[model samples]
Target: MAEAFERGGQQAWFHDHGHWGVFFHTYDNFQLSGFGEHFDQPRKIHVFIPRDYEVSPDRYSVLYCNDGDDIFFGDGETEQSWQVAEKLSQLYLRDQLKKIIVVAICSGDRHYEYSHIPEDDGGLEEYSRYLAKGLKPFIDENYRTIPHSTVILGASRGGLAAFYTACKHPRQFPQVATLSPSFWLGLDSPSYSMSNLDKAFKIKLQNSALMFALTSTLLEPDLRPKIYLDWGLRDDPGNEYEIRSQCRCMEMIQVLTTEFDYQEDHNLFIVEDPNGSHSINSWGDRLPNILQLFFD
Candidate 1:
């Protein structure tokens, strides 16, 4: 049997495989032209709604994830993904997670879209606006989502974008998860060394905008969003481009804890996986834990 629903420009198909079911939808050619000049391109939005969605009257929480294609399909290069739909089904069946809707936004020019530093072309601001102003409202209006229960999540450069977007619009996205964010983008590092710690720390200190964001959260603790951050200890400096990812992740933790006064395992949780790496497989393995932190 087949059933379907449509809302605004979005459409969903109910797939029942006897034992279980899932609602898959595609928002094809989702345009970002109204948000900013830099975001004139169109992107696809892949949404997953649980099988019981149509019959259940309960509103669901929303998880907006970046790198939509990779989150579901496993980046073609790595042959791995968060396997979000499969994981969600398992958790729902086990009653470990509350019913939640997941939306993954495909990326266009990832570096330009995710970076905080403005390339001569564009930067995080345009992308944040697209999420906060453009895409979010559409989802809210079309789906049965609790207003304050929404969370935004991403990994790597996309992770940086997730945090940055939440920081910019805490009222819109009050909860965020970042998996190994590329926080070293605005700094310069020729090589990694134990000696580079002080230098790297100093460079991050000079990031006035980042400092202000963290400090502002401290100043108004009540309005601060719950945050989840994770980094793999095994994300070694052996990789040339990511040599600073681990160091910067530590710096981010330090600033959030010391400067922002975000308590560990409280409103803020940071997980360091001794065996983790900078790969989707690693992030996928940690998704269950991450979702529990956000939804539980």
Candidate 2:
């Protein structure tokens, strides 16, 4: 059963960045409406504001990202951080991209919370409601965000979460970027064998959040969010499982283009990185392009 869509009236306070960096404001142990009942604990929310945000009167587009610790403030050397502040600073300084605010939601029990399909034991729908009904409104109320101009992004399992959230709540997130998403998740087997490729593909297509959203009579094509997908050709090197997963990703892209009529270089953007790997660095490397595609 789906939980009631509700928002916590509790106010969250932001603290100094301290070691994180200048552009970030940290909100520790921030509790969302339904998260306490559904999740393990309150999540740490990080907001990245543009450098001149205070002086400027202009509102900014918002980027909501999963895996806050990895994306926003992981240590530079040991951890493969996305370096969102670094990249955003550079882009803003160069005037290459629009001024944007980033809201990073930290993960807790990520494997469970990020799962999309019913076969997977998780609170994906609850999590999605938390974002759409909980976080977005909070951010809008406190921050100067341009209405209806929000994008959600994530990689791997986080990518799956982002995709599902955007599909379920398109009005809240009109643009979404998924890097090497784990679409093969929740299948009978974690990895697909060559002989069972067809079966896996059918199951995925039938159960896909994107498919459900698009096929619905209520959703118009224009209301569908712009989708960006990227995958590394060398994600798992010679592993047969990774290769088959990559093939599935390609098939999904094809279906989006041919069946859904999502035009390339427009609503749909795909990148196949030959040198990319299934790691934070690779996703970080590709993020700049995504930012440009959506915000520039």
Q: Please, what are the lDDT tens digits per residue for candidate 1 over residues 156-262?
A: 88888898888887778999999888777666554546555676557764364555544565457878778888887774656433435667777777777786777
Question: Count of backbone clashes for each model?
Answer: 1, 0
Leading candidate by TM-score? 1
TM-score of each: 0.87, 0.84
Question: How does each model score on lDDT?
Answer: 0.76, 0.74
Off by over 4 Å in 1: 1-6, 10-21, 75-77, 119-121, 190-202, 205-209, 212-218, 235-243
Off by over 4 Å in 2: 1-22, 34-36, 39-41, 75-78, 191-214, 217-219, 235-245
TM-score of 2: 0.84
